[model samples]
Target: MKICLVGSSGGHLTHLHLLEPFWGNKERFWVTFDKEDAKNILANERKYNCYFPTNRNVKNLIKNTYLAFKILKSEKPDIIISSGAAVAVPFFFVGKLLKIKTVYIEVFDRIDKPTLTGKLVYAVTDLFIVQWEEMRKVYPKAINLGGIF
Candidate 1:
């Protein structure tokens, strides 16, 4: 299956990278920030840089939404996956409209509270995974997959 891996730089990126066991054999491309760490980690991988400072950045959100549409259309991945901060929002929403399956793994650190991106994508995510059982209380439909680390 073709996979579209999307996340921010740093820990979010590492979280997704840890899932290489699953994505490693699949045809995949990434959507993430064009940062030094991402550059180093994904040096040999196919990647598209997304607009960042995405926490509450409205302009970048709009830009990313457009980028999502463009990339999703062109790549047409079978699934979209993320361990996210904020960049996953536009891709999940647009992926929903395009009928692409989505999986959102709530960050390992947020034991009981939900990340803003998780809350936003929960309704549309096909599978919601949480590292901590406590997070299931916050995301009632989430499955506890234990920590990826």
Candidate 2:
């Protein structure tokens, strides 16, 4: 299946990279907001740049929506898997609207409480996963899939 990986930079990117063993030469694309992470990932494969605004203002939300629109039209991915902050929010929302299967994996560090992205995306995601089973107490629908990376 054609899969799009979405996340913010740093730990999120690192987390997704762990799934490399499941990849072949070219079945996936990445969507992220970090310049350094983009540079590193693009050294081998192409990726989509989701906007990372300096201000968390309305303008930034608009930009993210536009970016999501373009990506949905261009990529037409069958599935979207995300380790999110905020940029992945629009993509996941658009993915659901487009009838694509959406999967959101909660961050490893967030065992005590759900992250904002996790809580918001839970309603739309086709699959919601948590590394720790403890998270299931809060979100019973979530799959305790262990860790992806």
Candidate 3:
């Protein structure tokens, strides 16, 4: 199966990195934020196009939407796995619209509440996972997968 790992830089990327072992035996793709620090990390690798302004910047949303479609159209991945933040929102939606399975790993830092993007993408996601088991009570659909990375 072709799994598309999407997330922001920092911790999101780290989480995805941990799950990299799972994809070593399967065809996989990655999509992390294109920040100055992350630019070279995912480069020269099999990762898809990266985005900028990793935060909830206004200007980047529209651009991200277009890029999302481009990635979805080109990659046509079978599934998407993401660690929450705003950037993953567009990518997750792309997978949803394309009828692709998606695994969402809630941010490790969000212990008591849901992140904005996490809440937004929950309904459409195929498998919602969390590091903390307590989150399962709030997000009844989520599975407790412990930590990714």
Best candidate per lDDT, number?
1
The regions of model 3 sitting more than 4 angstroms off are 36-40
Model 2 CA lDDT for position 93: 88
Candidate 3 has what TM-score?
0.89
* lDDT values, one for every candidate: 0.96, 0.81, 0.79
lDDT string, candidate 3, 88-119, tens digits: 88887877887888888888887768989889
Top candidate, metric TM-score: 1
lDDT-based ranking: 1, 2, 3
lDDT at position 64, candidate 1? 97
Candidate 2: the clashing residue pairs are none
Name model 1 segments beyond 4 Å from true: none
Error of 1 at 132 (Å): 0.7
Model 1, CA-based lDDT: 0.96
- The alpha-carbon deviation from the true structure for residue 122 of candidate 1, after best TM-score superposition, in angstroms, is 0.8
Q: Write the per-residue lDDT of candidate 1 for residues 9-101, one digit (tens) a residue.
A: 999999999999999999999999999999999999999999999999999999999999999999999999999979999999999999999
Output candidate 3 Cα RMSD. Answer: 1.8
lDDT per residue for candidate 2 within 12-55, as digits (tens), equals: 78777777775555488887875886678656876877777623
